[model samples]
Target chain A: MPAGDAFTPDQLYDIERAVRYAEETSGLHFSVYVGGADSETRPFAIELLNELDDPDRTVLVYVDPAGRRLEIVIGELAKRQLSDSSAGLAALTMQTSFATGDLTGGLVTGVQQLGTHAHQPPMLHANDEAHKL
Target chain B: MIVELSGHSLLVFVGIPVLVIAVLTLLVFASSIANGPRYRPGLSWWAPPVWINGPTATKPDPANLPELPELTASTQAPGATATATGVARTLGGASASW
Candidate 1:
């Protein structure tokens, strides 16, 4: 790890893997941002969410370590699948980890939880013909 | 009463113990040293902002973004609306602070 780097390569790998898993499971684009905010954290996070290619179906996790703030911004389409309550639960999980100075842990666990909560199970036979009598 | 401390005794009691303590201290701090600085709440952050799976991997200057139209009910459409800047009118999620 470099002197000012926020995460070691291994830690970054873990976080990326967790994000990938979340995206794969939930079928929603997942993004993570960690650092200081130039302005208010919420608006900063919203700006980040707007930067995504598919903002309507993306989830942006913004962490302002210096400000001790965490903002999980869900896109318009994503909100339907991942409700505010579920996001709140995930936020609680992250808050616990972050309070202990474990940024990576918080991100990984929170993302995983979000993915799980947002997961939509395949509806089998929905498109199939009726069964023979 | 004056007690004479032999060189051999000094090596066993002082030198060896100091060496052991030094090794233990290194072992305890080695992980943190390798990891560089860890994040502590309310402390100034050192690393540049990171955006994984964003529009660009590098952080963009907030000032560089074109000013967006102020969000207002009159500006909104019938149902869901996204501004020309792609800022969504409906946003859902939770906020927390440690």
Candidate 2:
């Protein structure tokens, strides 16, 4: 890893895998940002969220290690699938890990939980010709 | 009378034990050393920001992000900037601190 990089190659791989899992499970874009905020953490997080290709369908996880803050910003459409309460549950999980200085573990678990909460089960009968008729 | 210590006896008693302790210490710390620095609460962060699965288009610097305008009931559509578009109105999630 570079001197200025936050995670090692293996660690980054884990996070990216979790992100992929979340996207597949929830059918939504997932993004993660790890750094310090220029201003207040919440609005900065919102700003980061808006920077995505599909902001309305993206879930942005912003973690400020130096500030010891974590913000989970879900877009309008995504909010329907992932409730604020569910986001809170994930935040709580991340918070516990962060408090113990486990950034990678927290992010992996929290993103996974978010994806699971927003998971949409397949409709068994929807694909049937009889149902289409 | 007390026996005087010889050079070989000193090496066996002291040098071997010191070597064993040094090896043991290295073994205990090897993993963390390889892993590099870790994030600790309230400490100054060292690395640059990392964005995974972020926008394909290059984004403006966070430090230079335009000042957010006052939120209104009217929701603006997401444009290129999407900066002025108020997330407070539609954004929902959670906040936490350690």
Candidate 3:
């Protein structure tokens, strides 16, 4: 890892890959922020989510390892697709891995879970009504 | 008679053991030394910001969205009824049931 970077290249790569998978599976924006929060975690996470272009459709995962805090915030629209319970489940998975200091593994697994939970099957019937001969 | 040890004997007694110990230490720690330091909690982080789907990522930026209208405090009256449906329902009003 470079002097200013928090994660090694390999670690960053793994995290990025996990984010990609999460987005692909969920069709929602996924953003991860790992750092110390100046204030309360949940509010801070909400602030971060609001900074995005589309907070309503974005899911922000904030981890404060130093403070041992993990927050998963789903925006208004995102909450419709990913319920709070599902987010809590993902948080539990990440929390366990984080407690063990397996950040990469935890993130990969948690994000994968979120993606799976939010997965939507393609609608194949929209244009089929008029096509049946 | 006083006996003096030769330099070769001194080398075998001290130098070889030191060399063996050095090699053993290197063997024990070679992986860690190569991989560098591991992260410990509460320590200062050293990495830069990495945005996986950020502007730097290859994915195209989402099209610009229409700007939202600003809501000022004056626009919303105080003590208005807030509904659980996330809609504002009229409060302090009498209604006839159908």
Candidate 4:
């Protein structure tokens, strides 16, 4: 934590890097919302997702530090890339860090995990020339 | 032999070491000092919201946007369109608490 923002500039850089890596790995838009929810978080997060450019291809991570709640919302198309079980595992990783008062660490690791899970490697031998080997 | 020092000599010898110790202490705690408060569970948080990797392009406000009734109230209507986009959608997600 810093004077102005919740994180230091270095921490912000780390978080942004994690977000960028996640997006690059998964080919899905990733967004993180950190704050208090006006009311229930899930619906509010869905509303936030709908506000995105492509709601169907996005993953939104909502963290309520004050309320100590974390919600991960995967868009329809994004869900195909990122499974609910994977999201749950990421959430577990974040929860452990967050419970220890490590917000920045939690976010970075969780988002990174999500992105890794969503990654799809190219088919190894889908080419006609591969049979020649 | 016993040695006696003047007040100025004591200031030079004793005060300088004290000053050095103070500076060293400050340097050691500099990072923690720079980073003000830390988030501890069960304690109230005071920072504002931070959105990372958010939308590069903004859209019209919700007031101006059309809504699909199903998404508006999932429990209210069971037979309405299954998604906000008027198509059936399967969403994957997780939730947790600190």
Candidate 5:
């Protein structure tokens, strides 16, 4: 736990657990990056998303503690699944937590919301082929 | 000549060393206290990427992904292409389609 490291082991665990839960519920790829960005936060986040193999299907959460900024960038396909408004709401939730130095709590709640918003119910009529005939 | 060795004098001697010890103790730990929590950058990240309900195997590097077969005109369907799904779509207005 040295200074400038992304997060302490415990902090990382909590964030990862939250991510896991979000991914499970939403069925979307979730990535979290906590560090300072050399450029504008939004574009920097987009760059990070591009670094991933499937940028169009990934949701990346970027936090810049020193700059006191946060960005949640949803990829093209991800944006369709998770709207900007939904992401904004989650951002508000996380902003409150981060302001109070409660990064872990904020992330957990926000990620859960993302997951819930993206949850898709199973299609029950897929196997009813006889009706078509 | 009258000499006084009172309780006040004895208390001073004892209190002075206690204050000195407390100050010294604080000085020893002051650096750690001021530094707060810290993390090193560029090293292996603390936790592995957690992918819930994701592929059971480790996430493959993008560079390592096998090349996909190129779709050529010979194999392409007429006026149809693979559609990307799983993304939510928002429909505007009350337009009905048959």
Candidate 6:
């Protein structure tokens, strides 16, 4: 690993894979930011979320590793799929791992948990006559 | 009087200690090296920020992005949810600290 890099290539791959899995499972955009915030973490995280191409449907995970802070910001539309309580649960998972300095493990686990919480089971035989609403 | 180190003495004293020290060092640092750098609270951050799964493949210029307004008392009112991009947004999120 390089002297100043936040993650090794393997660690980066692990986190990216988790993000991909989350996005695939939830059908929502997932972004992760790891660094300090310019201001209060929440508003700064919100600004970061808004910077996404489709902010209304994205979920942003912002981590201030140095400050030991974490924020999970769900988009207006994405919140429907991922509730605030679910986000809190994911944050708690990350908080525990980060406490032990397992950033990659924390992120991967937390993102995977978020995806599971937001998962919407597929409707079987939606067009069948008996299943019509 | 001249004293010399035979192959047997070198192997017993220098070679074995060096091998054992090397093995111990590897055992101690193997996990951290494999996991890469870690962040300890209260330490100055070392690396620049990393954003994974960026919204776009290409990086957009920050200047073109809209600025978030100063958080005013009124703007934070229960029903005053909106974003800098003119999109009415209600943010749902959770915060945590170690």
Prediction 4 global C-alpha lDDT? 0.85
lDDT of 2 by residue, A8-123 (tens): 89899999999999999999999999988999999899888887888889999999998899999998889889999999999999999999989999999999999999999988
Please say which candidate is ahead in DockQ: 2 or 3. Answer: 2
Q: Candidate 6 vs. truth: CA RMSD?
A: 4.0
Q: Which digits, one per residue and each the tens of the lDDT, describe model 5 over residues B45-85?
A: 33322322232345456456665665666665553222222
- CAPRI class assigned to model 4: medium
Give the alpha carbon lDDT tens digit for every residue of A17-129 in model 5. 88888888777788777666779876676666655656667777776665667787676567667877787778888777776766567777877877787677777777798
lDDT of 4 at A98: 97
Task: Give the lDDT of residue B95 in candidate 6.
Answer: 96
Which candidate has the highest DockQ of all?
6
What is candidate 1's lDDT per residue for B23-98, written digit by digit as tens? 9999999998887678777677778887877785555665688898676767665544464554546888899999
True contacts kept of each: 0.74, 0.82, 0.18, 0.76, 0.04, 0.78
RMSD, one per candidate, in order: 4.5, 5.0, 10.1, 4.6, 10.3, 4.0
Q: Give TM per candidate.
A: 0.82, 0.82, 0.69, 0.80, 0.59, 0.82
Q: Given candidate 1, what's the lDDT at residue A33?
A: 93
Regions of candidate 4 where Cα sits further than 4 Å from its true position: A1-3, A124-133, B1-5, B9-17, B34-36, B61-89
Error of 3 at A120 (Å): 1.2
Docking class of 5: incorrect
lDDT for each residue of candidate 3 in B30-56, tens digit (9 for 90 to 100): 975654555455555554444455333
lDDT of 3 by residue, A1-133 (tens): 2255556677778888888898998898888887767798766666666556665687788777666677877766776678777887888888778767676778789878888887888877767968666
Q: What CA RMSD would candidate 5 show? A: 10.3
DockQ of 2: 0.54
lDDT winner? 2
